[model samples]
Target chain A: MTVAVDIKNRLGDFSLEARFESAGRLTALFGPSGSGKTSLVNLIGGLLRPDQGRIAAEGRVFVDTQAGVFVPKHKRRIGYVFQEPRLFPHLNVRSNLSYGRWFTPKGERHDDMGRVVELLGIGHLLDRRPSHLSGGEKQRVAIGRALLASPRLLLMDEPLAALDDARKAEIMPYIERLRDETKTPIVYVTHSIAEVARLASDVVVMAGGKVAAHGPTAEIMQRLDLLSEEEIGEGGSVVDMTVSAHDESFGMSVLHSAAGEVRVSGLGTPVGASVRVRIRARDVIIATERPRGLSALNILSGKIASISSGNGTLADVLIDCSGQIILARITRQSCHALALEPGKPVFAVVKTVSFDRANTMSGVKPG
Target chain B: MEWLDLSPEEWNAVRLSIKVATWAMVASLPPGLLIALLLARGKFWGKSIVNGIVHLPLILPPVVTGYLLLLTFGRRGPAGAFLAEHFGIVFSFRWTGAALACAIMGFPLMVRAIRLSIEAVDRRLEAAAGTLGANPIWVFLTITLPLTLPGVIAGMILSFAKAMGEFGATITFVSNIPGETQTLPSAIYTFTQVPGGDAGALRLTLVSIVISMAALIASEALSRRLGRRMDLE
Candidate 1:
């Protein structure tokens, strides 16, 4: 599925001029706060009318101002999950989940209520009122409600922003399941680099109400310059890996990828499952020679591809390991001390495996 | 038992007051909800003017409101003449005329209560409903209306109580007539004008208090029940 958007909207002093087409199943609109990410998703969902330009998804025109074509939100067949749950307080979980089905024509409805309820693991909550639910449960119900509508495209505007970290962790796996299992294309909006690394197949970088960059997740993730000052620390390389085996003796799991095998402690996922891992550049240490007494377990030998220095004492080195690129950030003094340059052989020592919920995602294997 | 005794005329007055108030509340409900929705959500020009006219009966003297009603709804008045000729409906010096007067006098209270509740509704929920594929009308009916039911009940009770206590407007628009347009308040007023009528007026006065108190309690219980159902409490 392809989502095509070229729209210009002026809200007060902030004028958004964004144009991009993403064919990834899950495309992330990634930016910091006040960057018009939410506004871009709103334009796609038909909640806001654009002053100019056209928007089409899967070859169906949703809005074309010059052509006088504007499908209302209800007829747009697009689902939206807002920052807040926004569930109807007066309706129970069952009714809220089925609300959109009442408006969809009988012949066009494709989602089954039972399947949606099970998909979100909200079957037990069908009778409870929205007010009685916790933050995570409410978001799950909201997702189920939108899915039951069988929208052609889904727009998520910071679905996890309102939740605490524990709640966000609880909802992330379900979202990953949705991205992998559902047929609907999703345009997710978030100000979090960690979320984009874990959840998005493609990323659209927004800055000052414009599309600063757009590319595949791996390519866009390496461009640390595209991140803001605060998010620069979180920028890293994303690698798709599969769980190869379980080291039950040490209670660890081994992940196999093009970059080679890496063992992570405290992983609970079953073997043969696909997982995406993000290795932050700040967490890597480069060794001129392969050290023998090092406590760190992950080490990959590769020739240095390139290096870019940031404004601080740190410089990012790109390592092309078996055709898979891994980024490492080190100080310029170390670079000079080691005489590191392009085509120089070196060892990249991974300090720690980020098994944190924010950096790891399951169930999306590279095709 | 002896002091509680109500003569036939007093009973007729009590019964007539109940009937008139019920009719007033019922007949004005649809229009009250409509106008409340308009005032709360519609973005048309002259909104403030429409709001001022709806509230005219509240601020104007009851006697003035009654006079205006008589001028418009009397047999010789243009609206009255058109209705009487086209639909054979008349509101001149009759019990139905008393109901019309009470409804007009109570309209502002009902609309105000409903409008406040409508305004309190979280518009985000409505927008969410729209994204869920509910059209505007469906969103209002399923989400907006259910959420505002407590206010609707409060408005209905306010209208009923106002209609029950109405005196100046009803008496001026439809002159008091025994066994016809004479409401409880009108009967009480008539008793105050005559000698040896204190006992009868005292009896009707107690009944009026009981009805009004009952309405207040019922409204409270109903809104609380609705609140609990919505998990809003």
Candidate 2:
């Protein structure tokens, strides 16, 4: 296991009990604001001690209550990127970035300042103070500072939460690069499902101070019942589709998966790159038969795997196209009119415009 | 020019006052910082009582504080006797005793300024440092202390100015011995008591104003420079 945590802690009237193990390169702690996700990250980072539990990363035990062992955060070698990019105001960017390097044991150090600066694109900001940098630039410098420490486990607590949409867009690609290129394991915290779908390979869904579900990103995302009410509309199937061809004339790209070809807006990456696409259940429309000449461009024939209805107003239909699963939410009247049921042949149609840049995460170069 | 020029006796008091104030300011810094940090960040059973005791000199009459210092540090006193016997130190009517009294009198102001600054420091930055492998002491040295530079300078100046003008406490704790413990304030008091000493008192009063104004201006410039360096301004 890359990271393992079984902990119980209490703060005032709120208590948290979490247990999960993940070996994924980027594991997301997904939850709403008050769901104790940050507290869990703090526990893993050794910032908060658990009243009872054991936490280990990379086969080294950080805290084991039974054994009476609790390592301090400084010795645990965990890098944390907080929500506010807490940079030392008195130090220049160069000094702040190198601050951790001085404390890391020389023999154990692996992070090269040159490589980290290049990775985060913060070379021009070395001489600037923290107050001089913009929000996006500060966050990038913060990431570089943490990476320079050469931590064994990197913990990010909503690193982009304080940024606007434009800034979030700017910083996300660097985080993806860090996930893909770095050797260290990362545990990211976020309440945004879009962020989880874009970056996380594994997810631990938290609710009401407990682990509601924990599994691979794709599997956990499709379980709409596990999502909060606000997130239910956004929850759906996440599919990794390889870029097989790009229709330059039409300004569209064809993504091939096991299910079928999906055409979205023109992508920036070259052909053969793997991109993750989120098909929101609310955006999907289920049909009894293959519709002819509809405005919706993408349609995949599948069999209805399951139908679940809550409160008798709407229903969620799960369709299996070849071996890939797709989710569609429709009204109960339409569900009953079409006589949808398990093992029934159907087609799941989605409009090309429904898949915007926010729904598509590209930049994973195929290995 | 003849009347403005200070006599040798007046010069001695001015020199002695500067030495005592400088010594008092320098000697109290380390303890002042430690105590400020403790009061700002520590959580203990008698924290309020510690805070109260630290502020006692500020609230209590200067004479009472000076008398208390005399009673504790005097040669016949228990602490005074032990220190005198063991360490060959003396506090009665000595310049060092005046410095000790000034340091005590100025301590509350120093600690208050430093404590407020320490409390204003963003603890999140410290926690971030901890996660990056900086131990607690390293965090204080690199993050906490550097960020609190302006306040530290302010506290030092406050303590220095308080020591420079210190009269009641110094006089009571250590008597006005002209070449030993007669600081500027004591010297001025002496000039004011005599019949033909008006010119000496006026000259020394002008000197005191200049010194106080210089200390304040120096502190303002220093803190502003630090603020600019930290981008806090």
Candidate 3:
């Protein structure tokens, strides 16, 4: 495991008992605001001392209350990217990026300043002060600073939460490159499902300061109870697909995945680039027989594997198509009218235009 | 020229006042910053008490504070006796005593200014530094101290200005002596009390006004330059 956290803490009246192990290079702490997502990452980063329990990474103990082994944040060798850029305003961009290098023992310092500056594309911003940089530039510099520290694990607590969608997009490719190319593991904290789908290899879902679910991204995304009503209320599955072709005349790109092929609007990386496409459970429609002449452009035939027993009029149906699981939600009346059950063959329909560009995360290879 | 009109004795007073104020301001800077950090970020059992004691000079009468300092730092007092015996340092009726009085009197303003600036420092930045492998000391030195430069400058200026005008505390503690401890304010007070001293008093008053304004302008310019360097304001 790259990171392991089995800690219990109490802040005011809220109690957080989070226990999970992540083997992926990028592990996401997924939850809504105030669900202890930031707190969990902070605990791992040694920013906050847990009242009880332990936090270990790759067998090295960071925080173990039982042994009274609580490493101070500076000595822990864990870099943190906060929600705000948190750059030292008095220092210029180059100095800010190298601020952490001042503390790292020369022997442990491995990341070259030039390499990091080039990676983040901040070489031109070296002399400029943090105040002079835009929000996205500041965040990239912050990440570069953390990388220069040569930390064992990087904890990013919603590093892009302070930026708009455009800025987030601007900085995401760097993080993806960091995840794919770097030796150090990263624990990213985010409340956005799109972020998790795009970057995370493993997911640890948090709710009410507890670990609601923990598994790989592909498995956790389709967990209806974890992301459905009463929880996030935004239930979806993230399909890892690669761009096979682009039809410029029609303004659409062809996506090939294990589940099926899909065509989405908007532009991103060129052909053969991997992307994460999020298909919301509610947006998927189900039919017992193959329907023809429908407005929807995509339809995948699969066998029903599971039907969620919902107290409401709606229920979620899981289908297995070519070793990939697809989720569809239909009303209980329609379920009974069609006599839907496990092992029954069905077709899942989704509109070509319903897919949003924001949901299409194009960076990093699928794990 | 006003500078040429001053008598040698008046010049000595002016020079001594500058010396005392400079010493007071410079000496109090480290402690003022420490106290400010303690008040701004420290969590302790007697935080409020420490805060109260730092601000005591501002609320208490200057004479009382002077008397208190005299009791502790006077030649025969316990602290004074220990210091004199160990380090041969004396504060009774010496120029040093005047600086001490000024520092004590100006401390509250100094601490207040630095504390406000320290409080304004985004603790998130400090935490960010800590995560970057900077120890808390490094965090304070590289992040907190540099960011709080404006406040430190303001505090030093306030202390220096307060020291230049300090009279009651210095008179009560060190007693006004022409060459030894007489500052600008004390010199003006002495000139006003003596007969045929109105001209001297007016000259010194105008001098004091000119010097204080210069100090304020210099301080503002220095702070603005530092602010520009930081690009924070």
Candidate 4:
């Protein structure tokens, strides 16, 4: 599925001007609160008409101000999951799930109720009231309801924002499963960086009601200079790896990446399972020569790809280890001492203890 | 015990009161719902003016409202003339005129109850329904209407009760005609004006109180049931 949106609208004191196109399964709009992420999703869902813009999903025109073509929201076949899980209070869970199906033409109904119920794990909630369900359960049911509509595009605006950390963790996997299993393209809006890192195949970074950057998640996250400028300090590169071996004696897991194998702290997953590990630039240390003695467990040799100036006194060093990219944040003094420049060989030193297992997630397919 | 028995005229008054109240409530329901939806959702020019017009009966004296209705719907008036010529319908000095007066007097209460509920409905839910492929009208019928059932029931009950007690408007518009326009309130008023009529008036008063109390209780019970159904979702 493909979605193209170019819209300009002005609300009181807030002006939204955004344009982005993506064919990714899950394209996340990541930004701070009140940055117009929700507004962008609303525009795509036809909940809000832009003062000037053209929106087309799967080659069907939804809104085109210049052409005076405006399709109402119901005809657009776009499903929206609001932050509050706005379920119809008068209907039971089953009825709410089926409410959307009534509008779908009989012959055009493609989404099976059994599949959606199983996908969201809401089978047990079919007869229960929405008020009786937990917050996580309500969101699951909301998603199921939207899916049953057989929408070509789904817009999820912070579906987990109101949940606690445990609830968010509980729902994230289901969302991930939806991303992998369903062919429907989704535009997910959120302010949480971890959520974007875990779910977004494509990332559109929004700041101050404008698109700061948009690209493949890995490439966008690796641009530390731009991310730091926008106050996204935790932004870093993601590497796809697989569990090559597990050393029970040392309590460590060996992960094989495009660059090379690196040893990290124990991961619960069995060998051969795919994992994505995030290595923050701030946690990386650069060495001029191979370290003779150090507690750091893993080090990879690579050539400096580029050096970009960062906020205040810091600088970002980009390293290319076979085609994989790693970022290191260093001071100008350290750069001068190492005489680092493009084509200069350096060793990227990463502490195994600094590799947070909690931050590490599995199920990323290798390229 | 003696006051419990009603004479023929008192019985006719009681029956006319029931018919007038029922007709009035049924006649005003559709328009009340429409006006309430507009007042709750429409963003149009002169919305406040429309709101004032809907509420005018609440603040205006019943006699003045009755007079306005009489002038507009009288046999010689434009609306009355057109109706008489096209449909052979008549309201002047008839039981229908009495029902019309009661409906006008009770309209404000009905609209207010419905409008409040409509305003309290979550707009986000409507938007969600839209994304789920239900059109706006369908959303209102399936979501908005069911959720606001308690308010609609309340409005209907209030209008029915108001219509049963209508006196000044009914009298001014249709006059007191035995077996025709005279309802329970007007009957009680006439009985009180004559000597040796206290017992008859007391009987009708008791009936009126019983009907009003029953309606209020029924509405309360119905609203509770609706609330539970809505909470299921």
User: Model 3 shows how many backbone clashes?
Assistant: 0
Indicate the docking level reached by candidate 1.
medium
What TM-score does chain B of candidate 2 reach?
A: 0.98
Clashing pairs in 1: none
Over the stretch B128-214, how does candidate 3's per-residue lDDT look in tens digits? Answer: 899898888888888899989899999999999999999888999999898999999999999999999999998888889988999
TM-score of each: 0.96, 0.96, 0.92, 0.95
Candidate 2 shows a clash count of 0
Clashing pairs in model 2? Answer: none
Model 2: CA > 4 A from native: A353-367
Quick one: best TM-score, which candidate?
2
lDDT string, candidate 2, A1-367, tens digits: 9999999999999899999999999999999999999999999888899999999999999999999999999999989999998999998999999988998999978989999998888899999999999999999999999999999989999999999998988888888888888898899999998898889999999998999999999899888888889888888888888889999999988889998988887877678887888898888998887899797889998899999998868898999999999988899999999999999999999853233244334455322
TM-score of chain A of each: 0.95, 0.95, 0.92, 0.93
After aligning candidate 1 to the native by TM-score, how far in Å is the CA of B62 from where it should be?
A: 1.0
Kindly list the per-residue Cα lDDT of model 1 for residues A1-367, writing each as its tens digit. 4799999999999999999999998999999889999889989888899999999997799999999999889888888999999998888999989988988888878889987776788889999999999999999999989888889888999999999998988888788878878888889999888788888999999999999999999989899889988878777788888889999899878899988899888466767877788888888899989989988899988889999986779899999888889899889999989999999988888887554373335453211
How do these models rank on DockQ, best leading? 4, 2, 3, 1
Which of 2 and 3 is ahead in TM-score? 2
**In candidate 3, what are the lDDT values of residues A1-367, reduced to their tens digit?**
7888899999999899999899898999998888999888888887789999989996789988999999988988988888888888888888888888888999999899999987888899999988888999989998999999999888899999999988988888788888878888999999887788778889999999999999998789888777734544456677778789999899988889987888777455677777767777888889988899897888988999999866898888898887788888789998899999999999988753233243334443312
Which candidate model has the greater DockQ, 1 or 3? 3
State candidate 2's DockQ: 0.74
